[model samples]
Target chain A: MISVRGVHKSFGGVHAVRGVTFEVGKGQVVGLLGANGAGKTTTIRMITGFLPPDTGSVAVAGHDTLRHSLAARAAVGYLPESAPAYSEMSVDGFLSFRGTLYGMRRRDRRNATERVLGLCDLHEVRRRRVGHLSKGFRQRVGLAAAMLHDPPVLILDEPSNGLDPKQIGQARRLIRELARDRTVLVSSHILPEVEQTCDRVIIMARGQIRVDADPKELLGSLREASPYIVEARGDAAESVLRAVPGVERVEVTSRPALDFDGTAWHTFRITAAAGAIDLREPIAATCAARGILIRELRREAPGLERVFLSLIEADEEGLPSPPGRGRWPADGRDGGGSPGGAAPQSHGAAA
Target chain B: MIPAASAIAVREYRSLFRVPVGWIVIALYLFLTGVVFVSSALIPGEPASLRYVFGISGWLLLPVMPAVSMRLFAEEFRSGTAEPLMTSPVSDASIVAGKYLGACLFLLTMLAPTLIYAVILAAVSDPAPDPGPILAGYLSLVLLGMLYLAVGTLVSSLTANQTLAFLGTFLFLLIALLLTGDMAARLPGNIGAILIRLGLSTRMEDFARGVIDTAHVVFFLSVSAWFLLLAFVAVESRRWR
Candidate 1:
């Protein structure tokens, strides 16, 4: 359990984190999403008791970070960004030393080190110097050092930065497994990894919280507010579907059926208000009234990419979008408006 | 505080002996002290007393202490490990004291072999050597090392570059050492007497003459405390940044 209230941090003339506030409940895996220099690491540092906030307070498991830093730090297991480690120490020795610093007894320190080595998949290289290991292994060793104390909360800054895809997947699974009984706050720039690993998402931009919601409900609510695409195939399906009320737009396509002796099948795509009475019901009723049998009808919902871009653009343009319904530009694409249209991918995400 | 201090002390001591530079420092210190000891005590017409030998060996600390304390906090800052250590449960005083003790211990190891100088003088003397002066001289040498180490620790905390730490601390100690002796007499009236009395050479005079003055003891202790406090404050100021 962690509570951060109106935390602000600045260096020289630059404001790194500005009045950010959020709470993470026990056993919750929260992903801190942000662009480069978006204050994610700064926020993590404040929570971990490394850098005290310039203007607010952080409490970890009821211990005030400023007033009772030792207790607060005792409750936190932090893996710093870049996996910075003691170069001269071997994997086992480093973990042991970190364990001692965390106040573990020698015997318990060794036991915890052994357990974390297995959990992070670092047993094979336990005897090797940390500087001699590969980047992925070094990251794993960093993870082990953090987990060695068995702290109730884990704050990891860019934990999956340099790992390969498989290693990232392994780390994701490990975080999820660890989150079963502890709080996890993982910061990352990679959106999908957060989507795959975190239970809740906190998107930050320009030193402020842009959006915070369950990844599923957030996207679903956005989809309900945006345009819904419907495809139908039947005799005069295009006109019949377009005739229904609330059908704001329509596109028609024709394809010849190979088994039907070259008889062309008509398909219509209808775009309408999200909850306009499931346009299929009325479209089917109208088709039946016209004696045109319907073949297929399916609704295509907008993806999360649309919702995220809409929110970010709204944030950048200084526009006030709807509270829960994220605003998006019509042509869903990545930020900066690149031409080839390589946008973030989205799939079925429900709360 | 003791637990944290001991934890840091053990770590520092281990790193010193485990690395190549640690041995190199000890070897280099012994060689330099040997050269100075022979030039002052073993020369053909030089005095048989090892007083000059101990005195010059005290000057040997001018350059040696920077090597020992340059990496105290500076290397930690540069390597980024300072984050975890500073964020840990340890206090600033404990960290500074631990590092100072580590440096002192290294200086002691270097000073250990030089005791043979006193032994040689005792063996080849007209009357049995007065072990009092020998003991007092070694005590002053240790105090001088502590004073330089405190300054070096403070300098290390001021910058992350070890080279800068070395140069900064070296210059600071040199200035502090100069202000207390012949260098001070050239200045004004009462100030010159006070500076001469406080200078390393003047304070160490009683010890070289086989008399330990409480004033000199208090002076070295005060100097050690002042610099160590500065080092602690320097380290704590990092919390603001």
Candidate 2:
């Protein structure tokens, strides 16, 4: 539904968007993931025809944004960052005004306003002045205005930024429901929200796309390239498991059931081979020979959080690392940490 | 272009009615003009005229005009509401024209009640007030306000801070007003004439005296158009930056 070719935009000496290019297919939910000031907003402005790219072009629904801006803009609904709206206008008034700007008929404008108010759960507050609403309610009002015309494509920037957890969940669900019929491109710094809501994610850093892949594919790649997590039950389990071939790290867990039963039992999680090996079978066989009962022996899959951290690390290294893969081990052995190497890590994980 | 212009005009008109600032400007202008007309005509015991009324109001708009136009684009830029308007299908020229018309309509309303002073002056005076100067005076007031509104709008487009926009535009008008009298004379004769022609008070003096020179009218119209065009260019430049 949309194509952007080598789009570059600069603000004076600062390059905000640098030769970024991507496509959004019809009825697809794509998340434009990036940290603050990653040129996502700049790229969106170009695509929506709000600003022409300094170089190259952006096309929406087969219409050139620079040459046929009116047609392109008419087919796209944009929710700008911060959900800006006229404070003096009521929720209904703003939506209707926006609808009229999009050239909707009077009857259809009213109908669409009502429809979108319901879609964004803004019916009860339709008559309220926009300035009087809370952040979450204001966000819904912004969303309703964008959706009022029922445009084929919806571009939202940080749609859930100020919302509470419950409201964020609701907004995410609403965005997903919207994608069932229309193309949606949402930008956000929140990684898990994108994983749950978007079918594919375009990770951006600096002024370029770092990785663009399906959520499942990213997760699969990470599992194949990161440490595997394993758990088993045995005497001296921590030491024994740590000694197992390919085991890089091991930590102990308390069994509350055993404590309640007046007996001591321990659980250990092991990090092992990251690639071309299934440590579960070897660990199971080792445990069986050692008379250690294998209570749980499974490979832990990497979630979006891990993949996100890994990609950020890759960006810091000044290279585009494969998606779903963690930083490569320096010793050429998977799951082994090199204490001397300057491995990039998140503060959250390091703490 | 006309439909978009009409839409912006109606919306601005409604906004004026809804906001108290519009009423305040009108009421203040009327009360102040009433006092000036009474002092200049009723107290002097001379043939009554609206010449002094136009003189005071034209000078009064130096501050008042900026107050009204300061929010024209500044509020939109601050609130980020300019995005939807800029991103819409309407051209920059249409937006500038619509806003100019809106401010002009407000100027009309402010000028409308001053006619009451004209009527009251005629009723109590020995000689009826001259309608010729009154018409010319009102025209000058409208055009002067237009010129000021355009400058205020261009200043407003340069910043998202309303107070800064107001101060910046007000200072600019103050300088322009200063150039009309003793301050402008100090300059060389040719430069002084240019400044005098560009001066709000000097251009308005021709209309206030009931002499509607085409050159003066065109000057005011061009001044208004030039600032408005600058405002349009300023808004368009932001997208590239």
Candidate 3:
């Protein structure tokens, strides 16, 4: 339903979106994920024909955004980032006006307004001025306006930004419902919301797409590449743990027992080699033979947060990796002290 | 395309009456025009007519027209409603034409109540006022309002600040109104004569004298169309940035 090709946009001397390309199919809900200044909004503006891209083109349902803007815009239902509306107008008045702009006839406009009002659950406050409503209600008003024309493509930028939990849930459900027959592209900085709502995820960083994959597949591949964690306590536990087979490196987490109090415990996190055999039993057996007490031993399952952070970190470091192996390069694998590397280790217990 | 423009025109016209500023501008205009009519035009010995009333209202529109047109595009930009508006299927020319028409309609409403004064003049005069001059005078007022509103609409499209739009439009109309006659008289050769002939106020005098020259009508319409075109260009320039 939407095709963007090598779209590049710059403001003044700064490039906001550079050579970004992606396609969204019909009935697909794609989540655009990025931190601040990632060009998500810029890319969206280009697609919506609100801002023209400097170089490449954006087409919606075969209508070029720049060449045939009216037809392309007619196909798009855009909800801008802040969901701005005419504050002096009532909800019904605003919707009716939108319908008129879309060239709907009077009877059709009235029916569409009533349909959207009920669909967005805005019937109760339909008569109230939009400025007098709360943020959630105002968001619904924007959604209602966007849906008023029944456009085939919906582009919403951060639709769940300031809403409460319940409202966010409602927005997610509404988006899901809208995506049942239309193409929906939703951009958000909230990772979990995207994970829960999108069928496919596209991660952007510094005006480029860093990673694009299915949410489950991305997480699953990252989990398969994750390292193992083994904590042991006793005299010389670090050396014993490091001596085991298939152990790549062992980094001790804390200072060893001092003053001979016999109460101090030492922990070591282990990173095993690719295709290495199960090191958990081997490490346990070694610890037992060495009179070391095993405190904890487990393999960490990488979650979406870790995958996202790793992709961003890799992008920032200018080391673009193949989709799955980008998390930790072989040579740069220090035991877990790297920035964003500690998240997976700490969250390992929960997984 | 006409339907789209008309839809926007209808909305703009309805919104004019929905707000207090529209009513306030109309009331203030009628009050000032009524005062000017009673003090200057309604004399005991002089012949009863709407000559002074139409002229004074034309001058009054120098300020009143901007008040009505200042918010035409400035408010939309300031409130961020321009995104929804521009993203819609309507073309820039249609939007500009619709808004200009709406402002012109409001100006007509402001001029409508002054007709009562014309009625009173015809009723009380011993020799009834000539209907020809009265019709011409009203036509001149409509043309003058259209030109002013078009200029104001162009200025509004240039800025997001309503105050700036108002002041800019006021200064522009002031220069257009003040510069042509006095400054044109001082210039040398045919340029001076042509400039004086182009003076808006000078052209308006013929209409009050009940002479509807095609040249004057063409001038008013061409100027209004020029400003509306400029507004359309100003709006379409957003796509480049």
The DockQ scores of all candidates, in the order shown, are: 0.39, 0.58, 0.63
For A3-114, candidate 1 gives per-residue lDDT tens digits of: 9888889999899888777889999999887777767888888887888899988999999888998899889888888777877788998898787777788899889988
> Model 1, range B103-158, lDDT digits (tens) per residue?
88888888888888878776766665677788888989888888888899999999
Please give the clash total of every predicted structure, in order: 2, 2, 0
User: Each model's interface RMSD (Å)?
Assistant: 1.6, 1.7, 1.3
By lDDT, the best candidate is 3
Predicted complex 1: CAPRI docking category: acceptable
User: How would you encode candidate 3's per-residue C-alpha lDDT over A1-351 as one tens digit per residue?
Assistant: 999888888989988887777788999999887778888888888898889999888999999999999999999998888889977788988898889889999999999998998888899999998889998888889988989999999988888866889889988999999999999999887888888999888777777765556776666655555677766666677788888998987877667644365655766768776557778889988889889887678887766677667667766776644234434231223222322222221111011
**Root mean square deviation (Cα) for candidate 2:** 5.7
Q: Provide the DockQ value for model 1.
A: 0.39
The candidates, ranked best first by lDDT, are 3, 1, 2
* Candidate no. 3 TM-score: 0.87
CA deviation > 4 Å runs, candidate 1: A222-316, A320-351, B18-20, B43-48, B119-128
